[model samples]
Target chain A: MKLVNSTLAALRAVRVNKLRSALTMLGIVLGVSSVTVMMAVGGGASQRIQTEMRNLGANTIVLNSGALKSAGVSKGQGSRPSVTLADAQAIENEVPAVTATSPQHNFAGMQLIYGNANWSTLVTGTTPEYLTIRNWAVSRGRAFDREDVIQGSKVVVLGRTVAEQLFGNQSPVGQEIRVNRVPMTVIGELAAKGQSLAGVDTDDTAVIPISTALNRVVGRNPANPRAISGVIIKVRDGANMASAFSDIRQVVRERHGLLPAQEDDFHLINLTEVMRAKEDSARALGILLAAIASVSLLVGGIGIMNIMLVSVTERIREIGLRLAVGARRSDILGQFLVEATILSLIGGIAGVVLGLGGAVAVERYADLGVVLNGQLSLVAMAFAAGVGIFFGFYPAWKASLLQPVEALRSD
Target chain B: MALVAVSDLTKTYMLGQTAVPALRGISLAIDRGEFVAVMGSSGSGKSTLMNLLGCLDAPSSGTYHLAGQDVLRLSSNKLAAVRNTSVGFVFQQFNLLARATALENVELPMVYAGIGWRERTRRAREVLAQVGLSDREHHRPSQLSGGQQQRVAIARALVNQPLLLLADEPTGALDSVTSDEIMATLVRLNEGGLTVIVVTHDAEVARYARRVIHFKDGRVVSDDLNQNIRAAA
Candidate 1:
């Protein structure tokens, strides 16, 4: 009965000081909402990384040409001609862990024209195995065949973005689109791959046979006509990525005839390792954001304590009157404690609402994915109540220690 | 047997490093159904003695028995319970909760007594009606006159059906007409077998009581029955 009365009394007191209560609750509201938003953003980022990694294909690695020194200055990766179509074939045949390989030569800034409409896009030339190496599916028609590559056929596979840019809603398959003034027949359209980790569009390019690109389009290089910029390799399932990486490196080095003391002209990128590092950083960022937000909750608790102390001093006569009417010291303590808890709990409930709204706002306006669950909200509420009790203790204790005679005597 | 019995009661106050005696060795007894008024000046120790008798403050060295229970020997919590069920205090300020309704103010003691809501409301209404404030039950203390607020405080004091009603200058804040009205109410309640003790320096207020005790320098100088009780008026 005492608890019930005290709670009611607390609620009444809060209602009486409307502006002060609302201002006090604002701190907690902001803290909880920010915490919720940070956790959601972190969860969303990690999830996106996982999907991007999946799109890159499981147990896949990319081998790009390392720097080449010219006049004592080094050109960056992919700037030198290192790996070739022959090296790709050798790695697949020699390494037991290697499942599929595709040597790629990129022709960027290629203007694609289709009857009055034209768009500038990248054109990647590779063998038929490129589709399999990338786990890319033909959404509209069939992918190019090995016979097409051997015959040096002028056939192309348009990406979802390229197809949409040139054809709008129309199907690009079997249509003729001139690439750099060379008319090529579109064989199929690749499925949309969305954005990459660097925020670049992945579906804004076209794929063609390497023979067609090297022999007819760009002409052959005098040093190594068959040299390619990079090779995409798919390792066998259940094989260790690190071991397969070293084995592929060894095979590439041997095929290139590099001595043991010489530096290799290629670099390997393991998608799994990149994904793990990205996830770790995301988790760390989440903890940092949560830590910063919780400081505001602590500040809010201190604000409540400050107000409760003032209230105790103001209601000295009321406390004395209660004591004279047979209120135990514990009852006085319990009453103030209940008041503080109710303030924070109500703030917490409001914060949960505000936090969910904030998460949605980030997802919509900030263009970041957000993930909010029931468990996070519940934990926030419980923590808010705990903060109330912890900070309200000193003031409630002070109120309880007051002497009835002295308190009643005070004006 | 007396409702209140005190033997050799003494209370001392600490004024920084000095020990000031508020109450010297004093002994008194007031039986049930008696209306007693203790009159004294500002530094006469009448208020300190009243505080001790109401169990609001413990005596420095004394024994106090209220309705056969040793009040000074009880634990703090037990003493609080005794104060709740055995004694009701009415302050000169009419110390009713300003924000609470007259009904709620009357129910405060019963609330502390752990009484259920329905029973508390019932008894609170019963006592408010006794104080002739049934129509003004929902009025807050600020909304009522000084006399009405005092009546509400008295109703609060009587709600737990205490063995003793300790009124410290119950009419000090009221005008002469209102004071008479409040004194008349106390006299009528005393006639109904309630033990009442009013502490005041007003000789006029003291005349309403069946017995008057005068205090000077923490010592009772006189204890005598009133020859002509003002309640007959």
Candidate 2:
């Protein structure tokens, strides 16, 4: 009953000064909304990174041909064709930790032509195990078999986006599409994988047999027909990836004949390491935005203090009157404190609603992904409540400390 | 026993190292059911005396026994208790909460006393009716006339059924006509057996009281019963 009276009295006080109270609450509203939106944006970015990491297979490792060195400084990554089919095959044969390895080669800027339509896209050539390594599913028809890979048959699997570009809405599963003047039958279509972290469309590519890419297509350095660009390895479910990576590296070093002092001519890209770096930066950005938002809340709290001080001064006579009429000192304190808390709580509730709307707006109009976190919104509201209490204390104390005689005597 | 008893009650204030004596060694006692008028000009310390008597301020020295209990040594909480249940005060400005209705203003003291809502409202309405403003219970202080506002203040002061109603210049802000009406209300309340103390500089206002105490420089100069008392008419 006491709480109800205080709340009603506080609400009536707020209602008496409608515009002033709204202006005071405005600061809190902006502060809480900013905190919420910042948290959602940060959380959304981190969530997107997690999804991107998942897109890159968790246990898969990429073995790229190492950089070429001219003088002391080395050339950039994938500078040479140091990785080859022999190294990949040796790792698959020698490494006990190895589950499956797929040697991948790519032919970029290839014109895929149908009867009346033509589109430019990249074509990758790999074994059937590449499908399993990359978690690539064929949405339609069947993938090329080992027979096709071994014989270098002209069979292709179009990605969803590439297929759409070449065949429009039509299902081109048995259609013969010419790949740079060479006719290849479309045996399958890969499911849409969306854009990568680097904003590149992963679906804008087609797949074919390795032998078909290295032998039938533009054979680079005919003497090095067995050369491959990279190797994709998928560790078994229960196997440790660290041991598997080391095992693959040891096998490759021996195949390349690298001495103890000589650096291996290949690089291993652990998917998690690359993503951890990205996630760390994302987390740093999140903290920075949260700090900025907290500063805004502090400013909002100051606004509340400013208004409360004015209120205390303006209501000195009223305070004296209450004090004279049997109100204890604590009663005056409770009244003002409850008023401040109510202002902040109202602002916080409105902010949560506004923040959710802001997050959705950012996701839609701003083309950013936002993850609405229920727990985070509640924390923001709790912070607002804390702001109210912290800022409202001083003015209430001053009011409670007023001598009833002097206060009644105030003009 | 006297309802209010004091001995050498003194209050001294410090104005930046200057010892300002608002009240000196002076004491007085008033029996229950007495309508007393305190007359003093500015700087005469009548306001300070009223503040002490109302339990809003404690005396700096000396003893104050209210209703046969030592009140000077009581803690602030105990003082608040005395103020809540024993003494009710009306201010010169009719200091009702500007935003609250006249009914709410009257109920304010009961609210602090932790009274239940139904009873508080019922009693507040009863007091408003007693003050002859039953129809204007919902009017804010601004909406009411000066006399009406003072009546509301009186209703608030009387709602607690205090042993004494202390009024400081209760009619200072009113015209002669409204002042007569407010004085009549106080006379009627006193006739009902509630002790009433009015602080005023106006002789016309003081004539309504059964006894008048004149003070100068914090010392009581005269205390006497009125032989020719002016009725509320």
Candidate 3:
């Protein structure tokens, strides 16, 4: 028999029971929709983590001093020994792969005053290289130059949030601000960087050259001339990160005069390691979502199989008449399979639309950066078709195997 | 040569553990262009013989030749081919696919024979017009009268232009007037040089045929040419 004619006949047969056919197709719709939605959400989250990782500077590693333990109690419980400027210089000179290093001292809840308008924010003291290594951009005015850092000039760079809060809609360039009763000039303002995946406000911090911070602002202790908070090291290339980290650790150990086999005082954070951990967690979440979505697909396949069985029973007389008139068993099987495929294809098309709409809605309303992948949609459509064929086969086969005489005898 | 030749045809059924013989060593020959009626009371095995002749069932033991080919030795697929190209069937209940229109119903056999849609439609319309149902081509069987449905069935039987027509109780469900119309249509078809075999208990239906065979106790008791009826015609 001609395939087109057979398909038309199958369509007519399905039309005889429109309600049942629609109900059967509902399973496919739900299955495809669930898979698409899950994939969209998971992919969106993965992209978000990757963007945050990029914002943290791909090659930068952060190192902080560890607490010193003495007599079963940490001596630096609330205040660990600071990583001095000497340590930062040592890492830059001794580690061959270390391209740039900046010693940083951060103080939270610091009050900033710009022309009587004050805002409490995070204050950080670092060199000009800190802006590039932290992926920070100067939107207005100019970042502190090498001359300002060398001359110990009191120039400050305001984060977008601090600038906006202290001087709403007005440029804070050349304005004077007081940090811990020390007057500073705002030479630049950081661009608006929204937020990190860890929910930290990237715009809510202020920057100043470390020399000015050490001499004119937060003066260094007279007793410990090199005292500092911590240091951030940027590797020349991503491939050299591990070796640079080992070299920096060895230098720090030697400078601190640590004994052999003793734990180091400072801790190092490799951005790549954090990225890998985040990727592993994201992958696990994606697999869990996919598994849950598979359950929905399985349920939908079962629904299709059940409806097809009922359809076979309802059309037994027609089947018998077709067989009597010379329809081969394969023809009957093909007819049912075509019906199932049509149902699933329609569902897949609808699911793609729904999934993309959902992604767009989440992006707009929930403030999530979502990317609706075309490849995932294609995979979902193919899977829906496969499910239809897989589950549609047995019932159609059973229908084909029925004895024509017995089927004809059925009312 | 005979269109259908049967020798020592036997058919038995097993009801659980008991054996029942439906046809007992029956032998018959039907020539080309012959309108033969097989007449018997209910349970006389006339239906069973019709089934075997129509290729709807196989005989337990027999040598049957259809169109000079040994049908008894043919495989199922070959038998289906022979049935498709050489034989047409009309059941007592009409056996029309209820959902299909009269034209589509007539086109079914050609569809199974893998004819293209355009050709099947053309041939089905031609045969429906031949049965004087050209105006009712789009009507389903339920929408048509009993006589019309039977005409549609007959049109389907003639659609493939088979060598033989096997009809079982063609007028069993129709009134006397409709039955007469159906019988007249059959007589005209047979007169047009198409071979036809009809199974009926009604002697009135049997009188339309030129030859009649009577069955009793799973065997043919009489086979005779209707010379008087032919003379009257």
Candidate 4:
């Protein structure tokens, strides 16, 4: 009952000064709204990164052939194809944490032909484990098997984009297509994978057996006939990835017969680590935005304090009368504190409404994704109320400390 | 036994580094149901005495017993409770919250006393009827006449059923006619067995009291029964 009375009295006081109250609340409104927007934008960016990481495949690492140095001159990655199919097999057999490995040799700008439709795209020569390491699914027919690799079959699996261009609406499975003027049979068509984090079309390339590419299409490198491009390693779930990464590096280094002083001839890329770094930066940006927004909220709290001080001064006689009539010191303090809290709480609610609207507008017109977090909105409101209490205390204390006799004597 | 008893009540306020005595070694007693008037010019310390008696302020050196409780020795919170339940005060300014309705003003004391809303409203309305402002319960102070506002304040003072009603210059701001009307209400309430004390400088206002005490320089000069009591006429 006491709380109800204080609240009612506070609401009446607010009603008495409508315009002033609204202006004071405007600060809190802007503060909370901006906080809401920043949190939502941050959430959206984090979610987008999560989706990109899923598409890139989880718990996987890329082992790229590093620079090959000779005569004090260096050729860039994959130049001399130092990575071989035997190195991939050795890593899979040597590292217990490594579950699967897919060795690949990529030939870009290969012309794919079906009937009169000819489209230029990258052709990847990889083993069957590539499908598992890359999380790629075949939407039609079947994938090339170990038998196809061992026999060096002239068969290919078309990516969605290549399939669309070469076959249009018709299923390309069981059909024959030509890669770089070499005839190959279409064994399967891959499911569509959307754009990568770099905005490259992931479904715009074809896959073939690495043995077929080395023997028939691209031909072998004269220096190392068994040379392959690079290897994709999938680590077992729940195993320590860092340890697995170092273990693979050791295996590769030992196989290359390199000395301890020699620079590593291979480089490792942890896909999740790269994505997490981006996530951390996005989170940092969000914190910075929220910090900036809270400065406005601080200003709003100061405004509440200023108005409450003025109110206390203006109501001296009323305070005296209350004190005279037997109100406890806590009663007077509670009255003003409640008034301030009500003001900011209303402002916080208004801000939530405005901010949600702003988030929708950003999503629509600004082309940004937003995920509204219920917990975050609640925290914003709690913070607003806290701000009110912190700033309202001094003025309320002053009012409560007034002596009844002196207060009653005041005009 | 006296309802209010005080001995050697002295209040000294600090003015810079010097002490200014508002009350100097005053002793007084008033029995229950007595209608007494304290007469004094400005700065004579009658107001300070009333504040001490009403438990609004503690005396610097004094022993005060309201009923049986030691008013001077109680904590500030207890003092507020005594003021709420034992002494009702009315100021010359009416002191009604300008924004509150007459009913709400009367309910203020009960609100502090932690009464339920239904009982507080019922009792407030009863006292408003007693003060002849029952029909104006919904009117704010700004909407009411001065006399009507004072009646609302009186209703507020009466709502808590205090042991004593202390009115400091209750008619100081009213015209002669409204003054007599207010005095008549006090006279009728006193006849009903309520203890009433009015502090004022006006002789006409004192004429309604059964006993009158005069003060000069923070000391009482005379205490006598009124031979020509006005009888609220």
Q: Give the TM-scores of the predictions, in the order they appear.
A: 0.85, 0.85, 0.77, 0.72
In Å, candidate 1's interface RMSD is: 1.2
What candidate 4 gets wrong by more than 4 Å, as runs, is A1-99, A104-125, A136-230, A234-319, A328-403, A407-411, B1-3, B31-39, B67-69, B74-78, B171-184, B187-193, B201-212, B222-233
| lDDT of predicted model 3 | 0.81
lDDT tens readout by residue for model 3, B2-73: 899999999888899998988998988999999999999998889888877877667889888888989878
Could you tell me how far off, in angstroms, the CA of residue A385 lies in candidate 2 after the best superposition? 1.3
Give one digit per residue, the lDDT tens place, for model 4 in A387-408.
6666665655775676788777
What does the lDDT come to for candidate 1? 0.84
Q: Residue pairs in steric clash, candidate 2? A: none
C-alpha DockQ for predicted model 2 = 0.58
Instruction: Give interface RMSD, per candidate.
Output: 1.2, 1.4, 2.6, 1.3
Instruction: Write one digit per residue (lDDT tens) for candidate 4, span B1-233.
Output: 89988899899999999999988889999999999999999999998998888776768997999897887777778878888888999889898887789999999999999998899999999999998987898999999988998899889999999999999999999999999999999999999999999999999999999999998888888999999999776
Two-way lDDT contest, 1 vs 4, winner: 4
lDDT of each: 0.84, 0.85, 0.81, 0.86
Report the error of model 2 at residue A256, Å: 6.8
When sorted by DockQ, best at the front, the candidate numbers are 1, 2, 4, 3
TM-score of each candidate's B chain against the true B chain:
0.98, 0.98, 0.96, 0.98
Clashing pairs in 4: none
Give the lDDT of residue A123 in candidate 1. 91
lDDT of 4 at B118: 95
Error of 1 at A201 (Å): 2.4
